[model samples]
Target: MIIAVIDGMGGGIGGQIVNYLRQELPSYFEIYGLGTNSAATSVMLKNHANKGATGENAIVVSVKKANAIIGPLSIIIPNGMMGEVTDKMAAAVCDADAFKILLPISPENFELVGLENKPLMLLIKDAIDLLKKEFNIK
Candidate 1:
């Protein structure tokens, strides 16, 4: 299966997701790191994503090829990631046929109510658990 991990800014979140997924998922699964910038892509790549791409166009094109998409909640919000995420990118992600596994992390001025404010690592672990359940992974 192809799983796309999208992120922007420092890409620390995407990097952690890539690293965790790589260690947990079967070897046959492919992880694609899609970043808003080259530096973010590089971080995901270093964390062992099978492939990497950057920018709006890359995200638009690559998301269609994925079986699942995982990232921060901001990835689907227009002008998110401090404006690094474009409307086109947000639309593309929403329109993709892939299942989305979004972390609760949001941008400034955005609030997700009723959800526990878990640490990033715990949030990521919850995402992985959801993915495993969806795919029937052991």
Candidate 2:
């Protein structure tokens, strides 16, 4: 499955998603990074994204091409936090009929685990474990 992660200026969330997918999916899922700028793309590419594209159009294109998408639920709310991921991207991901595993973070969820500064590796592990039980991923 092709997995796309849409992120903002530095691709922090997107990079974490890519790393999680790589460690947990275990089937060589094609990872694509959709960054709002060059910095975001660089982060994902370094973490081993098969391909990457930048800007709004690039995100739209990834949404069109991918089989599945992953990110925070707030991504659904366009201007929620990351200006890169707009409502259109959220709608596209939802409407694409692709499997999505969104983290339970929301706009009002005041405590955010900053992907850069925090050890989200354990969080990702726990989420994937729960997802495995729910979806039987292994």
- Top TM-score: which candidate number? 1
What would the TM-scores of all predictions be? 0.98, 0.74
Candidate 1: C-alpha RMSD to true structure equals 0.5
The C-alpha stretches of model 1 lying farther than 4 A from their native spots are: none
Residue 122 accuracy (lDDT) in model 1: 94
Worst 10 residues of 1 by lDDT: 20-29
Highest lDDT: which candidate? 1
For model 1, residues 4-32, the per-residue Cα lDDT tens digits are 99999999999999999998899999999
Q: lDDT tens digits, residues 1-138, model 2?
A: 687776665668778877877778866678888776789888988888899888766776678777666666666666655465677766776776656666656565455565433355665565567656655668
Candidate 1 has a TM-score of 0.98
* Native-referenced Cα lDDT, model 2: 0.70
Task: Please list the C-alpha lDDT of all candidates, in the order they appear.
Answer: 0.97, 0.70
Off by over 4 Å in 2: 108-119, 130-136
Give candidate 2's error at residue 38 in angstroms: 2.3
